[model samples]
Target: MSGGRAEGPRNIAIVGPYLSGKTSLLESILFATGAVDRKGGVNQGNTVGDGSAEAREKQMSVEVNAATTVYLGDEFTFLDCPGSIEFIQEAANALVGVDAAVLVCEADPAKATALQPWLKLLDELDLPRFIFVNKVDRASGDVQTVTEALQAVSQKPLILRQLPIVKDEIITGYVDLVQGRTYVYRESGPSELIEAEGDVADALGEARFAMLEQLADFDDHLMEELLEDIEPEKAEIFRDLTDNMQAGNIVSVLIGAAERESGVRRLLKALRHEVPGHGTAAARAGVDPASKETVAQVLKTYHTQHGGKLSLVRLWSGSIAEGDVLNGDRVGSLGQLMGQQFNKLDRATAGQVATLGRMEGIVTGDVLTGGGEAPELRRAPRFAPVFALALNVENRNDEVKLSGALAKLMEEDPSLSVEQNESTRQMLLWGQGDQHLKVAVARLKSKYGVSVETEKPKVPYKEAIRKGVTQHARHKKQSGGHGQFGDVTVEIKPLPRGSGFQFGDSITGGVVPKQYIPAVEAGVREYLSHGPLGFEVVDLAVTLTDGKYHAVDSSEQAFKTAGRMAMAEGLPQCDPVLLEPILQVQVMVPNEHTASVNNLISGRRGQILGFDAREGWPGWDRVSAYLPQAEVGDLIVELRSLTQGVGTFTFEFDRLQEVTGRAAEQAMANAAA
Candidate 1:
């Protein structure tokens, strides 16, 4: 991959925890590669990656920002992924097309836990990755000790590629352990190589040997050489490091201060020499590069105010042209994505990531093939929403447009879900966390031109009878046209829980017309919809014992009116009770946090059913409980806080349980309001 398009572009993603300087590192890399004249800071908000208005205001990336740049005679496309857990899906989506990733993180040992989620994901994907300990200037503690702490969290072995050169408690530069050379930073330019001839030299030798030991564990030949006590050549050492990394067996650690542009050149050199090529990533994506069939996978979807839809895709096997028919639809004009700006392109070669405009139907994670063949792929897992809100548009007229916009939003990011709660009559938007929904709201306003609001969904509380009541109701009205008369004696009684509503009648001796019996039952059913308790009535029975009617004036309408009157007067007298929906929740958290989770459930008035080992997940316990629907609004927030942000659970509606005390009082008050 050269600057002149001689080789295919190499895709590299920069990912890490929030505020870990991933965007800053991207800016430093671009600056060091001469792709940009100056580096951009997050606070200044001029960085190429955080270009969106929401990102600028928040001073962090909220989505994946892919920028194409040429570095050291190689074509490189860098994917800057948001680090917040709220936007993890974006990072995971971008990883599908990238050859490798730069795991950016701080050097604070206390923050080592923050990297666990990303580490687990990378290990799951088996993608080759490098850890760039970013913001070293702000970091404190020995680099080796910090690396050890990180090692404990990472499944893959961590190899120290370079050691920080600290002078008087300050990071001055770095020493390349493999080459035994020291380099001093030169301010936005290339670092100057210096002689490693003292304590730095001694430390370099030891670190280099340690790195070799980690690498040798994966290479039999290297292990033999190490056991024989033979000094391995630098060429052999580099080859083993490169091979093991490309095989996803080891993670090489590098340190850098992206804000100062320090250690960026070394990071660039490592990327240029070590990152895997497109063919390897293609094979992993289940694509055959030799097949010569045009294939592409959408990494993202962008809806512009004027440009319609642009599907950012990566061509895996063959070239994509201005009007090539891919899968089903004809490809629109190809455009090269350089940061936030889009440049027109006649065609994009294999392995190049570009945007295809007017792709109205295409969505993220959709695989487009020339021959319409099913691409062997494990569909990218949808992001499980940790929080939800009852979403609504401001204007009633915008409801139709809002649904359409949400559909497109869902198409763009499958991590989000939209559901209509039939009982509550509210539309719910579920996603990762508050920030995720905030970005979605902003996009709805800016791109789709729709304004939306969100609130906690109303709990679907129900009402049921507690006591039985018998009453006589009469519908008698004498109009000048005809005399209307109908009378009924009915009984309302509570049934066993879960028995649902039942209607029965016993009209004998022609006391009431037989044809009017169904109309009486229909009236009873309609009145149940709006019970005296101001909620859906359930688990109750209405019985008709006897009734009288005037033959000439007693029509079905009159009989129906009489039955409704009977229930209306008798239900309130029967002692109606509020019933709250309880959910059968299975909360899965690390065993260490089981006590906290148990406390959380109990505090919410939940009954602990039992706890057991979570199926298929080691070291995690599943605590089953029954909790009221109202307490589940922000359960994910507390669970994450208790378990270092790794806890999750699944739940279903269990049954309706009678609620008492202040909870019932508040529910009744809210329903009245």
Candidate 2:
């Protein structure tokens, strides 16, 4: 999208970890902006941001929700993103179409690591973002400690703009570092301005100086003023803060209790006065501000119960009307979403997040143009699916309907993937984590009218012989018309692992007819399908040695029966064994937890190769290991738990290894069951 319509409206994303008060903040902002007369609470199941049935049922956001409001005569749209890591793709898709992000986080030091993933993402995008320390009123520790923890995980310097005012160990107010003024928070309405003295004044001086020092690092003039002991003006401080933040050189910090509506107005004012316009964001995204092309990016896609397909797009340049054709598809409708409510519009302006109706082929992260080819915009990185579930249709007749519904769900959520396993013959739904797949399953029933039974995917195991065996077998059948007779001898040998199955003939003197020999080989291959262990047999070779046939009764079918009988009787004598697939796994985590991860891998019958510092990630390590496919089913779940929810891993099939002991016994028993 081009940046020609840079002044239309600003889109901001509200992002953070789970239970960080983002939905509550969105509700308060909407209420303060007069978009809604009353505020909605997440616990009350009335929040405007998370209006979905699943979200309300769980009291957590499952996807990104958009709400628009007018603040200080400027129109703004806030994309409320889910806090759970499983749903991070929803935030990643929405962030690309926004001008800035407000990271809502709790005032707990222990939760600092949770912000690393979000900060790393914003840093990669070079998107200007501010940290909003929510629930300051309930903070158990000092705000400085919280900010310090946050700064440790953040790449950019954090400019503390405000300090919480504590009285009787409870936060009652805050001091604006720029304004050098203390304000007492009220139960309702704006914080009341108050005078500061003694310790309060002294603390404010130090905090303000600290903020100015950070800003001065980016502004030479401010640095000179500070060196010369000349106090900078409030306007000058604000100018530096805005410039540094918009330049992605500094991350500004604000504090508030969103549930009580405290600090909400101040947060809104900072966004209004400091957030760069959409034009700057468009330019940062590599779109030309002067181009006349009507370019937009699809931030989200939805399939409503009655409205068909709707694609939420951010109009980066130019305007689009209801009848305009985009990508050769007619714009059947145009509208905006405020929670679950839809406001119909005939046209949408630039820099606006609007919904295009009936955009059937459109998907999240798609770059759309009015005509011709659309410019290539940087797309969000797709996270590898770390968890999966085997789904079985509850009703046999719903299988066809289930496939169509899954396609629609996958369209809405790109992070989810579906695959039909050929070996196991099960439909597997893969996602970022268990919770992520669970939500997708819930949507299947709630949104698409499909009910499926879910279970852990079965391990695809195979069997092979440990030794060679030579056997001869004869098939004789007597019928009313004639008697059939065929005989053959074959040698079965074990090949090296991964050699697969091989068939050949060493017959001499025409002991077995060529036509009957072909039938014997086919029978042997078919018998190997279900070996003595009831699994596909691999890595073996069979040679046709000799056979006898009666000219009058010998037939291909008789030879085939003779070949099958030979294998069924001789394979048991070859000492058959089971084999399980192995995978090469690489676990990434902070160095502090490397040891824990190593132990975790060993406990699951994994062979740890080694670990080294993770490339491009400071203080992190990548541990490589070889684990059986069966051990990897819940590896991610335990890995995340061990690393405080920050660890991740990737795995691929390496080779098939022989399985023995109780593990093998259990696998065989389970297969028999």
Candidate 3:
């Protein structure tokens, strides 16, 4: 490393909204740095970022792609993260190990709303970041407006470092605010340095002064120099920029179009001079900097076709080599990963990200130490699933393999989960969105060789009685010398809303024997499993007022049959109703979209409890409502669409409420079918 900086690679994550050209930026960075012989295009499906078959088929990033390059004698690893909100977990997981992030965005002000979530996440991590307003060549508006729009969503001040040079209403080049020089774009390679004249020459001073003013907010020396109207030395100004950026005090903004490889070298130079080293990331992740132990945290996990499992990890404190025992598992191999390619490493030191092979028991976000003690490292937060699908194995022989395949998928991606719904009798796969679950299914088929059928998960509906009834029934059979006889009289009544199922007996002393009472209760419970409404019965009480048992032939099986007969005869007489699970939901969104969320809940036949400003979150609101489970299946998709993909919610089962009309009719029809 130069200038006395620590010797290690600078890990940076390229993140933004969908189609913001993050993968394109990685390709350009690699090509510009000579790490790759030629740049690859996203549409051509030859880029190192989206190399997976699933990503190529969808023409979008489905996971995090790591590529390494060198610029100006400093090593850098660029993690090209998926930009779609559906795959945001990939970015969240990768960011914990990175030194900083480059947030790429379009120049359109209308799309500024999409940057809020990414900004909020970066602020939470307190990671240094820079904004690259991409596609300036295609922008139809002024670059200042785009900078202002970005500033509105970011918590840190956005200091614009470049001024676009516009000609005939099209952006042709940019003036470096720091260097006080102008450059013209070269379509195939690095931009050409040019002399500033006319409009560019006149506008350079004001823009540069404005950038220095923002930087001075956190630097006392710069503030004094600005106050005295004295120009600061260029080296001093660069020092202030690097110091503030590494401290997370300000965000440096630059302009570029990654598809054309414009400004990529300039971007790399900025990174080389300003980006914090892996030491800063290790300290930020709560790793003990003074400790000499070998600690590494798994950032991502992948189960390869023929290579078993490979865990991408960031070594925090010491070096590790192949065959080292980490967290009770032997490290089979160690290497650096570039997309699908692996470069074998003799040893990996602290602050370097490496891939460990065959870490079978290890998972994403797991902290491993070769010293046998696990370090407490910061882990990525697990997102609550917002979408679900019920799976059916296409081949009966694959049924035994589904669980193992799903286990691997969940291991590779902590955001994915699987559940067995006892009431609905369906195996449900839960994820962030419909596309998220779809990609998971594709992986199961392609990667694991397990074909499956998927459908929307069935809501677990229940049944409750509206009234009470008295009924009597008997079971008698005469096949041989002894006959089976069981007679009973039961009083069935509806209880309170959440009383569940209650069973009691008030039989006279000699009429029914004591041994037969539990059998009768068991019989009642067995019948309740499927009520007249074709659902598990709940919120009702049953009393066995009287019963007759033949001394010779009466049995628990006979009494159970008698109880089932009585329920089949009595429940229809009482007004049977469908009861659906109601969830207590708290929907959190930006205050600007609060009104839309209220209307959304009402349209879904929900009851709004109240709404208030969410604590600790400024300019956001939490709306509390009671929503039916059936209506909640696709609520997240609509909520995100309404709030620019920033809205989310948490829910729990509150109670079972009676449902009628078309919703109840549909539930009944589905049950019958």
What lDDT does the true structure give each of the candidates?
A: 0.84, 0.89, 0.88
- Give me the candidate number with maximum TM-score: 3
In candidate 1, what are the lDDT values of residues 379-441, reduced to their tens digit?
455566768888878888888899888998887778899888877788899898877888889
After TM-score superposition, the amount by which residue 323's alpha carbon in candidate 1 deviates from its true location, in angstroms, is 1.6
Query: What are the per-residue Cα lDDT tens digits for candidate 3 across 1-673?
Result: 1243445688989999988889898998988889889888989999988988899999999999888777878788888888888888888999999988999999888788788878887888888998988988888578899988887777788889998898888778899999899999888788889999987898998899989888888788889999999989988888877888888888999998889888888898888778877778888999875577889989899988877899999888888899999989999999988888988889988878899999998999989987566867777766788889999999999998999999999988889999999999999999999888999999999999999999888988988988999999999999999889899899999999988899998998767787887887888888888999899999999999998999999988888888888888989988998999999999999898999999999999999999999875667899999999999999999999998887889999999988999999999999899
TM-score, model 3 to reference: 0.97
Q: Would you estimate the TM-scores of all the predictions? A: 0.92, 0.96, 0.97
The CA lDDT at 441 in model 2 is 90
The Cα error of candidate 1 at residue 216, in Å, is 1.6
- Local error of candidate 3 at residue 433 (angstroms): 0.2
Which residue segments of model 3 deviate by more than 4 Å? 1-6, 615-618
Best lDDT goes to which candidate? Answer: 2
Candidate 1: give the clashing pairs.
none
Residue 394 local lDDT, model 2? 92
- In model 3, where is the ten-residue run with the lowest total lDDT? 1-10
Error of 1 at 381 (Å): 1.5
lDDT of 2 at 149: 91
